[model samples]
Target chain A: MSGFTVYSATGCVRCKIVKGYMDAQGMTYVEKDMKAEGKEDFQKFYAANRRQIFRGPEGVEFPIVTDGTAIRQGVGACLAYLYAGRELDGFFSAGTLHKEWVDGIHAAGGNPAAGEKFLAVVRLLKGNNFKLVVDTYGRNPALLEKLLAENLVDVAVMEVMASAGLAGAIFGQPLAQEDIERSVALVATAPEYRFQTTVVPVAEGGQARYLTPQEVVAAAKLLATVTRSKKNPYLIKLYRPVQPKDERLGELAPLPAAALLAYRSQARAYQVLAEAEKE
Target chain B: MAYPSVYPTGVTIYDPKKCWSGYTIFQAKEAGALLIDMNGTEVQLWKGLHGFPNTILPGGYVMGHLGLRNNAFGMQDQTDLVQVDWDGNVVWKFNQYEYIEDPGEEPQWMARQHHDFQREGNPVGYYVPGMDPRVDGGNTLILCHKNLYNKKISDKRLLDDTIIEVTWGGDIVWEWTCSDHFDEFGFSEAAKNILCRDPNMRTAGGGMGDWMHVNCMSVLGPNRWYDAGDERFHPDNIIIDGRETNILAIIDKKTGKIVWQVGPEYDTSPALKKLGWIIGVHHTHMISRGLPGEGNILLFDNGGWAGYGVPNPGSPTGSKNALRDYSRVLEFDPVTLQIVWQYTPKEAGFVHPPDSNRFYSPFISGAQRLPNGNTLITEGSGGRAFEVTPDHEIVWEYISPYWGKQMKMNMVYRAYRVPYEWVPQAERAPETPIERIDVAKFRVPGAAPLGRKKETAIEGTKPYQGSTALCIAAAEEVDEK
Candidate 1:
């Protein structure tokens, strides 16, 4: 069939947004509320593709759009495919970190082809009037500068992966501090920007330790110095390792809310983002 | 038939030869103590009789509580611990433990009994071949709650766990409070700081700090360790585990001091390192003497959230400082802290990595070693109970069909398997082995057939002629131009 099916639940805000966008665009599709009239159909569909469904902490994600062969989950991916004709896999979206692009860069080994392909996709998406949001780890300074110079990104987010002592655990290979500084400086030039760091457990010498309050402060100082603005929005997100890639990091215990607040308090140089701003 | 039959609930699998066939008793979430035989046939059910856990005594006697205190006054507080015979007559009762007046409620005595209790004859409260629980007379050791404040534990009022042994005539014979031995728990300075401030405070009991939230407690009973000069594993020693604190400790009945323990910390030794962090654990007990793995410490190491320590990314508050996804049934040498036998997903025969969570229950579960060298596991959070042999082959399985109206989930607090002869009032059901249903084939009536590779047609569009794939390709082609 030419149309796709959108599986949704009641009171799901993102599901409503996607349906609204589709309606305004005059798109023809079927809507299935998993809890109500379409429960049986969803169940049959779910049973057939049980292994493919992504089960996260909140259980199954909603607004699942299936076009027979390819299944797009969550509002981000559904909108990306429906609006911009971009199929995303593994939580890929315009707003989140560009992990797929980073993986392409890693696979290309200093080749410019990966960068050109990404820029092309960005242009294609921009042509569709999609509000572009990008998150980067700042591994490639020149590429980040190019994106900023082109004025292609609406909102830019730079994620500070780790503080000094914990960098080796987070970054697989050594990333130059100068490159990170350049990327941070470039990211600030965007219309809307945020410096975010997710406090996660880092394994070193068979032991795991969380980024201490002092460590978080060091990252905040770096961001402040690079951007030359204490007003820069910095978000401290507590990571919940539901299914972590690193097995050793899984052994570490979860930090309590008090410690996170303590970390937020210690980073006086950084301007904290409100809770609603968190993903 | 009450639920969607994605998979059948009662008796999905049964292997009578491998399983130690018995009458499985558990408190259905709706209301009642239900006894099911080997075939998952409902043999008997005592309506209106509920329990944090319903236990079956010898000679057809069922033990449970009649009612629960309002959540506003107490967390999981039972009003009266009572026993009833085959005809549902209250044979014995106890409630004179604490007297309190909840807001807008009458002042009355509350048993305050919560997670667990054990009678004198049976050490673990479940059945063992030679040691049947006394139906006529036996003192009851109850794991109850006591609302009190101790500055050493926290500044707020503490909902501390208190073990009390009460006679058949409802007289308190002995008592031990958890907060009294707080210092002996060996909390680090950081953990202590967090504890003093929070103590895992809950809104129940008008903002009481449930510091130790001890979920399970039972007497050690006759053990090989005790017989071989390990005074710490004495027959009368009480074993209890704190759900909030990640501690499984034994209390000396005479002195009421913590003598043997395994967490709040697990890395103190090499053996404990292998055992890992036992967080949010339950049903910690020494295996009864007649059981195969007797003298070993058995517990359902429910690896969910618990403990106090330096905050990591996962636990932001540090109050519930530890976190893990999978559950493990661990049988270990308590003295050496070495894991003797374990039932993780690996043991449960899952092939893929990270499959450990497939056999997990984050909260409210238990393990019992049976006479036939098999273990009956109550994966309570999912309302599933199954029997596993020494090889970890699931010989029998049953999922509880009774879903709670208030909680909106089918969660069994605990389950116990007693010998068929114990409940002679009901005839034993014919033991028919039910094979595990093939999930791929099971489907609701009139639903689409599964595993067929036919293209699914989207509504409001013609099938095959203008398909979704072609539509996506057409859109992509337009973008490319």
Candidate 2:
């Protein structure tokens, strides 16, 4: 089982970091949306999740992840567990988890004992494990295209970070409209891909500061124009505040489930397969 | 699909710096009341009948309703409220409307006690040791519901919520009913109109309307205000919240009058304006004295399906969408009527709009004031419980791994943090401090291959991590700045 479950939420910088690290190491995972279908929905799995991870003492937070038999939770713990799990499972061990990741999990639920225990118990040696998502193609399109061309990508994840021209606010810089469109055309048109929008409610001083859900839908339709096939799965990845010295950012919330679903339903009208990946 | 066995399971989270060290006791859906240490380890369990909203007595005894096999929507139509020891031994028991029995121990019987209860012997309860201390009466306060049809109170048959004080010998020492003071709830013209037309207290299954489903009720014990001679804040007064009508009130147990209240009309008061719209609230109680921030009213503001304002007749017949959908934990002073502190998902670094349903649980959940000045919260819908410091740092967190047998939902009604001494055990486990993780630097152990699969033995993997230069098209080095 070379695959892991990427339990991620939108606007989660930790999720993005995990994605980057996974990309660098060539490790694959199945990105499960906490928003769309939750871990709780599957009762048996949830029961196992508790029995396996919680020992009546510590627990990992969101971005809870697992590679078949080996599971990790919280951003830091998941990463450390994943790193240690991969190496102990004998599939891969070249990439070293950052000391910070290991330390973070230790605090968040990842201690050395837990990391090692997870490795010993996880049997990621068999399963249809594949690198789940490949991200933000608009910012790193060329890198994503190369992965696709070489068939390294399973579900080519194209994150629509922002709706068209307003993308600069989220990326912290300007992204040319033409470049974003061209990238979407190239990546979304791939044989197999997932088009997603990490919808965040831009907030400043405890107030919303961005496009409304309807506007996002309009923008989503604009991006959907590039998709050559309606079969390409479309997603509304609900946003969370990404870390990086933006006090206003953490205050910025993900759109409400109603708004996200509204966006998804409207986006579906544009002939795109839409689903909500809320946290 | 089977989940990975090695991933983070439902472990208990304890951050020494933030959480108050204690044993958590809760009514697990299947296993009755469970007493566990902070690390998610089960210290003890009482596998007797249990239902939602269970609590712990001073000496590790557990009190909760016994769940049934075919309860509606997992709703507890509990025939009895039982108290058991750590070993699942039924120490004291009370079956509602029938008899109260402590067969093995004392062979005592009393009036049928039901819903919420607090014994005078328990310190993990409303009455504290100091401040406005009173004599130990060895009595218990209980919340009961009995159907009464009085056209004056309501045209339709109503589920009357009654609060009663009963002795261990089963004497109903003092009692109060909803219909007796139906005029005291301060129902607005609109609320009155609606209630008069049809209380709509009926459940979805066409059952009797569960009007004023009083899930919790606690007597305001000794506090700074009461000790200072505030007759209204007298130790014996009671506080309760109605889930259906969206009202929270403090009852003057003496005069049998509502001394202070909020709701039935929030838009009219300026103080309430700052308090925000509290919908379908729960666990509304005065933080007992001797605890940090004692005397303050703390409640879990469940922003679920509840209302008093249904567009007011001609204003616009709004659907359920008119209601707000978000949950909050609020602590405020009853004197100044000012919000002392609040915890929304915003405190957890979540912004609304995108994470709309983030801090929301329309139905079940609760909050508790910790001795360490922190607040413990349980998001019942998600079955997650956590403790946040006064400044809102989650020092500890836990997810109930137990699923509800009847509802098949992993919803934990409530959990309380009882100090280690509360359990009559010889030894207690030490707690460890967990560091928050850094997701940015987390890593997996894989390295992409340098060349084709035939070269590395695996048929086809990606290029090596060191060879990103060879895959320039996909791994472009864009200046993030």
Candidate 3:
């Protein structure tokens, strides 16, 4: 385990966020897309670390990471380790850290050598304990396809931005729906992957340009149509607007807790795992 | 989740000493609503629930909808509205699931309510404090969605918006659906035919077919117009707006008929078009008898795509048109339809219209006529709510910092200003009083916070090493999206 390998998801934003966090800490690791060979490529890695990765009675769920010895699975489990420092003690029991790691960095007075946040993050992600990133597949995911063809990756995950009516406006960019659908199809067939979206409203200029609750359900239905995974977890995350003020998505409102719940109820029609993530 | 001294969070651009003295209440799209003073201290967390059209009582009780259940095992996000005491106790709870019944229909039950709800007897729920000429008893007015059908209207099943008044005893005293009075909405023959074919509206239950999304509705309350003998402006009249069709109308609550409306066709009409197309407006409220411009309509003009564009003789009836890029706030006399005052990006100090996107939220913005003659506007999408004087000077402003229960971000739905007298224990803490800063000169100190950490990866490179090289193409492109 010279450099712990990450079976990266096809297109998962959390995977990206996690990787970014790790980069700030200066932790080293190798990244691979799990969908490289469809199920075949994922199967090899799955065989290597089968037990530590799988959970529940049936052995499902993925984005498994191993230092060739111990392993970590699921975003929550990995975050607990990444933020909790070394020892993996209380890793499963303690859960995610709510303290802002950047606060420690800020307190360091710009001295990267004395940065406690970086040191803590690196210590937590140390050794064979690699990470898998996730996000919505990028436009024209030819790289994702090529990676899937290679079968030399970890896992895959994606997110549905909005339903058909809002496909073009919400992201402040051309969504490239054909590629999204293709990536969705590829991930759905891949051995291990997840799909999600931030249930937040997009505002352009000071007004709300976010999809209505109706559009959220519509997007879920669209995802349901593409993925055969009946229980495909559509992780509806609480939205956090992009920082430093990008001109495109000015400001956005996150969906309300209750309205989000009602939305999950509405999405139940699609028979997918409509889950809400507390930001 | 970390950003440096974010706007709408921690009083970024505040003139605490200059703002009207009182607490502002608003629910972040993700975080539950909070009541804070000029100093930006949380008077009440009112956690566990999301604020939508929430109001504070004379006591310390906060009334709002149950936002998200963080501890629940099943569908945690249920539509259960609650009233909490000062200690955050559940004083009253209305589960939309158990209630919301419609008589004489097969399923009979309406879906969960969204956007707005009003408590009739209180008048406290009204945007302004005013006296009502008539008493309808204490009932809650709810804007709800339901799949409905009627032979009198189109036979095709439709997702209709219904306004129902429910009593504390759990009885629906009155019910009104917009679809029933379809003929009165003033749609052209072509518009009507096209709407029947594709009534563009969006919602979770309606899939992609929700037509006439009634975003906000409230009993007109007492207004000068009624005092001046305009029966149409009676306190009991219910004023509502259709986001999809862009129809701002006053329905005679007694007759349940739309007596006056401004849209469904602004482009075709001279009077309406000059006032500008009221495309996708929200939070329509009569200024109340006591406010400065009482009887005038205060509307947040959300400029965006709405309605089925009527076809010209040569063009098809179902023509689609691009929405105007700019949004405006209009305060107009309802009877004369004359705009008394207005605010736009240009007025907000923007150089050009398109640059005013900061002022334009195609949906989810609101306006309030404060007692001090200043208008408190919630640029809802931006999550920035501020108060501006009659002269258009911004005095107080806040951006919501709490991310919602489910999402990492939060945007405000609407915000209201209340006098210090309104909150019983309003002075739970001392006000720190913030001084407005030169934002251009301000910067967050130290290494960039987590949110400020920019992506620094080289194109197609891994953290460690591998001989696979990389995709190599599209490598120069940024990953900002």
Candidate 4:
């Protein structure tokens, strides 16, 4: 149980490479060729695992590497877990989270923390036996607002970004500084609403230039002043490249350790400013 | 006692009761009649002597030959090349009569012009002229128009047959004649004479012939010998199967020599022989790559041929006949020459009476490996065609409602499915609307002729009026004679 079991078939190049890597890392494991021995037993195990994790049957393929508590169905899944340096046993054993739910959140740029939070909310609602409903942004907002007023959902996770901020980034229409102030004022009326900003590095010329830490801090302070809110909102800096195919972005160096430290310091300073304003 | 179970891929039984009339199209009976669209309904495009029924390729185009019949004194069959659109319009046609001649003698054999027959003046020759014409790449026409007769010739030497590549306008672009390279009498003289003496060797029921009669031609890709850097995956090669010799050969179009061959050197490997016997196979087609069960050769293994192994008595042709009851689609690895996959009715969960048997006749049947991983096989003798899935389940079945009789013979040579897209927009017809008529209200015409005097045959019927019944009886007698 301390070691791993790598179920593979003969003539699979990927399986050989994976086993070689494990050996180099001094990890002991049991190897099984499903084709030569225990084909039916392996199929039964595979089907059982699939039913537990996925609602439908998974395609039958070789090299299902399992560490007693966790199973990786194919090479792609194995590689992803190896890079993450974490086992999915806890999440799977909980029986409350599905792989598809986690994958969907990840696809939409939601982090692991957000995924856990969403699962927790779903569990709470289900335990209460409430008929929960969810809709996309394009759905009728008035109906959603009505449901919210009726106290149908004890908690709701909604996505909100400044319209002016998005239009400026996507359509190259620069918004005046007052537009940002006005947007904050408009959303401040809703007590449950939270403002979210995604920080993406923009490439200009040959170097990736992120919004200066001082500028972010100043914006945060100004927003708090206009909205008359005391609590600093959560700022999630998503680190995906703005343009996938831009060669300049790839050439640019990572954020220097010193620069990252400075950014964190500025964020802390904004938190202090909001706290002081609340007092 | 329990028998070992064989699991099928899947089975889907189609019930006619749940089906609705989809469409109806009429096919003409001309020699090379093509399906054409007239007023939105499919009609045959009848032109100069149509002979063979059209064959549908992966695309919608139908390819077949045009000719009357092969006989001496120029009364023999001459092949006319043709490609018909789905709506039965002749998109292209080529006439080879000018270059071919039917010398006054015995029935001019179509095998004479094929690439496996020896040319005239060769010590041994088996040339039966005017045989099978095949079109490849929608532009090139490969004709196996000759045959050879020589006993001592090695199977490879039978490459003397000519495979002519002509354009749509009848221009011979390139030609490969087998006689120039291989010697017809290269084999032991005894083997040569025995093959020549058997005049009926090429016929289906004749003893095995020596000469490899190239019946079908397919081009693989451009010649790598001429242009080593040619990027095309398929080279310009031709596939010829000798019906009499039971040889499947691939001839290099450029060199006109046997590049690769199966049979004559075929042996059932220990593994395959342990499972079952697969003797003579025909209508070999290359299953397209990347499809389910791809990279294997699909063939109609007429297991009835009594060549190398002990013949199964229950074969379709009965005992003592080479073609008996065994027929199945076999997928074999071309390189390893191993039978990898097969489908028989028993494996598909169909139980038949002890007397019912199925087998393939090379000249009379066609098997198409379809894109959906099912095989469309035409049981020519029974005049039945069925679409079978990978699991050997019959999803679609059709019995030819129109049976042709040649001198009181009921035989179906071949049938092909015309994909709806291939028909030209102007040629396709709107679907025929089905209307049901009550049979009880139907009446027999009073003017109908009867061949004999009316009798009180029915228990409730009285005798017909004398003069009228007499007149009807006389009219029926005249019609009967």
Model 2 residue B295 CA deviation in Å: 1.2
CA lDDT, candidate 2, residue A241: 48
Q: What is the DockQ of candidate 4?
A: 0.00
Candidate 4 chain A weakest ten by summed lDDT: A101-110
> What order do you get sorting by lDDT, best first?
1, 3, 2, 4
Provide per-model DockQ scores.
0.01, 0.00, 0.01, 0.00
**Where does candidate 3 stray beyond 4 Å?**
A1-279, B1-8, B16-18, B67-78, B95-111, B122-137, B150-156, B201-208, B311-322, B404-408, B428-433, B446-481
lDDT of 1 by residue, B1-481 (tens): 0334356678889988788988999999877999899887888899979877899998889999999889877888999899999999999998877665778998676789999989888899898888878877878999899887899877999999988888776656577889989999999887898899999888986798989889999989898888999899889999999998999999998788899988888888888787889999999999989899898999998988999988889877688889887789999988887888988867886532234567778899999999988999999888999999999999999899998888987888889999888888888778887877777777779977776677786779854542224423433243355
lDDT (Cα, tens digit) per residue for candidate 3, span B306-378: 7666565433556334366668899987776778989887678754433556577777879888766788888
Clashing pairs counted in every model: 13, 53, 47, 67
Q: lDDT values of the candidates?
A: 0.77, 0.61, 0.61, 0.43
Q: B-chain TM-score, every candidate?
A: 0.92, 0.81, 0.80, 0.60
The candidate that wins on DockQ is 3
| TM-score of the A-chain for all models | 0.64, 0.48, 0.48, 0.36
How far residue B265's Cα lies from its native spot in candidate 1, in Å, is 0.7
Instruction: Output the better candidate (1/2) by lDDT.
Output: 1
The lowest-lDDT stretch of 10 consecutive residues in candidate 3 chain B is B69-78
lDDT of 2 by residue, A1-279 (tens): 366667665555556666666776798877765556654433445576664443222333355566677665544445545556543232122112222221121111122234334332221210122232334436434444554555544445566643445676655656677667767776765556666776655654467564565665765676657655444566777665434354654545444544454455456555344666633
- CAPRI band of model 1? incorrect
| Candidate 2 global CA lDDT score | 0.61
